[model samples]
Target: MDNKTVLQFQSLSSLVDPTFWYSLTKEKIDNIKLSDVPLDIYGYYSYNSLQSSKSNDNIKVPSFLQLNSNSLTNEIIPSFSFPMKGLLKNTNTIEDFQKLDKKGLFEKVSKKIWDSILNGEAIKCPSLLNQFLLISFSDLKKYKYYYWFAFPALLLENPIYLTNTQLLSDYLNKNELQSLHENYQKLLEIPDNIKKGIPGYFLLKKDDNNHVKVGTLSEWEMFKSDDKNKTIVGFADPCVLPNNPGWLIRNLIVLLKKKWNVSKVTILCYREIAGEYADLSQCKLMDIEISGEELSDNLPKSVGWEKNIKGQFGPRLANLGPTMDPNKLIESAV
Candidate 1:
């Protein structure tokens, strides 16, 4: 056959739908090459319920099968036909084939075939016919959830696979694993500086009237005599701060100054040294220290500020009435 005719036959043969088999003709069956005949024949018989039994007379036997009638009867025909007939006897639809418990079904089918082979009732063609039966059954089991996780991974361009760390460690030297751990630690640190436009670090203070203000130095110019009335708090690591400082400061001013009306916002430091702040202002102090490894392990559960205010950032902020006033933002910063 020419290339175009071969391509057309292939296109029709690949279809598994019952509609393809019901419309088959004797001339079309005769024209297909002998090697490609088995697939089409299997497809036709598997979906044979869509066509009446009387229509089988219209389909011609392939020339190769007619020439080797004894071999076809002894092996090839039984290999392709019986297992499909047995499977279809129990299954009504494609979904029935997919929902079958594969392990139990494989054991049951193999045992029956083995018994027939041992009794000399049916000839076994393990390299040919028997292989086809086992493979076709396996395909039916896989078609159900084949693309469940794969489709999302393809779209995201991040396919994840399960790995055995112990197997991988056996192949690598001890020094390589230590180097990998050190590199991981560097990745987790908060950077000292960000891009040029953003500020590095600063301190925030809560005054007697419960107003939050920011300044470059730890000590603010406006100071009161009573130590109990004022609170001093230090903030650093701007690289870890989400959104710009202007946006964050505006949200904090609205939340702390206007909404909560609190005298102070305290940050309990983890994994850091205590300071000598005698010269600085006296304030109510609470200290809780934790190791870096413990902080890393517990960070996800302890931090939830992002979940509460995520919608208030970026373009979504427009939905929240008017933006924070520029004059009030300037007043909050020294």
Candidate 2:
């Protein structure tokens, strides 16, 4: 295929980088090599592993987190599961790292990635933002923009899901929503009103072809499957914070809202924060029982689960969804 055809293909579809796409076709974008590209272009690259795997075999697009064991190889996606406390010792930026770390369980798994960047072993850690910085870190110092900046900003956002079930079953009662917010402020000392604009329902869409798609409560409409009878629902544990998988959730939500016209979205989270303290004030909070089966099917939004070229730095297998070349988004913006 010529460069134009490749470029055209990238524009019409979801891809992270044309080079990465080319690498995939040439068998370069497999499990473990890093691409030298800008982070913004590849920000959502491989948001889900299952989604990546399906993109190779199936012609259709899959959700970033829809993981089908049948379609994916058994190789586990490498990642470190670090505690919040341990990360503090290695890095000075605690809050920023906490927000960017998501799951707070990566230090050990991403050690190679971290060590590679620190020791200059490889290009950079295999993350969207970090990859770009690692590639251009020396010459780009004048820009004063590093991936670390996003870490703290996104962390300061403090976005989280508060399950209704958790509220009712766990600690907070309906009446306690307000007080809990106050308590959360006192405990975390994250400040008040900083948690605004957080949404409640994390909508996940999967097609009959076994492809998992993700979205926020709003994006639920773009992924309404051909089966008109299907009910769109929340896919993962509502309590989880914004990791790559959660980023998939955020992307799905953001994309759905942009592409589709829908109304009345809600979510069920597994934790209880003050209503004022919770990130999603717009959502109608409810306590519902999310089924285990639904969660399992909806989880891995894509087929390739962390088995792609970039090592453990990208989203987990559960996060990758259909994406276009990163060049498409970043180059155009420039």
Candidate 3:
């Protein structure tokens, strides 16, 4: 298949309901802690450069987004000011905001103050008249709150699998696994190097007609589909491992084991750090030692190979080799 075909096929699988996505989005949005907002927002109002110090971790949002208490209140449609002002700035970045940095951000906000944010005790500060620029002017649109705090939950949902016994059993009884099996068979028939296999973990279902359905993109597809514009970060030998990658990998395992009874699953890493971290027993990981020579080899040209780059197959194969950057190799695999 050509590049256009590959990209079009990828877009086909990624389609999802905007409404359903919004529902899932709103649940987490409602839980955002007031303190998880940005310090610059306070700067907009109080003109307090000191507010910048509120971020204990030096976290901030994109330089463009203007955050102000009045605007935040209007966006969230809250009746009061937030109790944990320091915490918002403390856990400033988009990622940090997701977790709300509860303990750290709210170290100063007393329970009473915290409750008030939730209870709407703090009224909108009139001093910040310029709030309209930062917020939706219409009361109806005012509910469009920005909660970086809720992001982690949404991210967590990104890799979510339908592993509940009932959901899995029903989907499988309907032919979900069979479809993947068919796809795998079709993939193997492709004539080429078959360079990689990045198996995405997901719940499957098979129907009486032997049709297969997937809860989400296969493991290979998820990582293979990483946006080309974004820099894909893998753990390098030079630094301590980031907590998020480990958590992400662990979640993948949990999803597979719970949904598909995937025991003794193997995950090969293109980098030494990934392999090293996989060595940890609690993580129940494994490593594929990639060397410089192995990384330079080209992928196979085959029918299934066509989709592999668009999916996880290329990266998986790349992980088996060490020298090449996994993300770069996969992007070029096609």
Best by TM-score: 2
Span of ten consecutive residues with least summed lDDT in model 2: 4-13
Candidate 2 to native Cα RMSD, angstroms: 21.3
Which parts of model 3 have CA positions greater than 4 angstroms off?
1-247, 272-334
> Considering only N, C-alpha and C atoms within 3 Å, which residue pairs clash in candidate 1?
none
Q: How accurate is candidate 1 locally (lDDT)?
A: 0.22
- Per-residue lDDT tens digits for candidate 1, residues 119-217, read 422222211111111112111211221100000000101111111111212322344334422332232232221111011122333433333344322
TM-score of candidate 2 relative to the true fold: 0.22
RMSD of each: 34.8, 21.3, 25.0
Query: What are the per-residue Cα lDDT tens digits for candidate 3 across 1-334?
Result: 1111100011101111223223322433565423333322221111001112234534311111123334223233111111112223333233543444333332222332223223322112111111111110111122222322200100111222221111122223324444544553343343221111111222223334566433322332333222321111111011112111222133233223333334333231111211212211111113211111111112111111112335542211112122233555676785
C-alpha TM-scores of all predictions:
0.17, 0.22, 0.18
Rank by lDDT (best first): 2, 3, 1
| CA error at residue 250 for candidate 3, angstroms | 1.2
Comparing 1 with 3 on lDDT, the higher-scoring candidate is 3
Judge candidate 3 against the unseen true structure and give its global Cα lDDT, from 0 to 1.
0.23
Best by lDDT: 2
What lDDT tens digits, residue by residue, belong to model 2 across residues 1-334? 1111100001111222233323322321253234332222222222111212334533223222211121122122211110010111112133332444333322232332234323432211112112111111111112111121111101111122322322222332343444433432342232111111112223333333333344433343464545442334442222233211222223223222222322223332323222223432211223222212211111122111122235333421211122333544565667
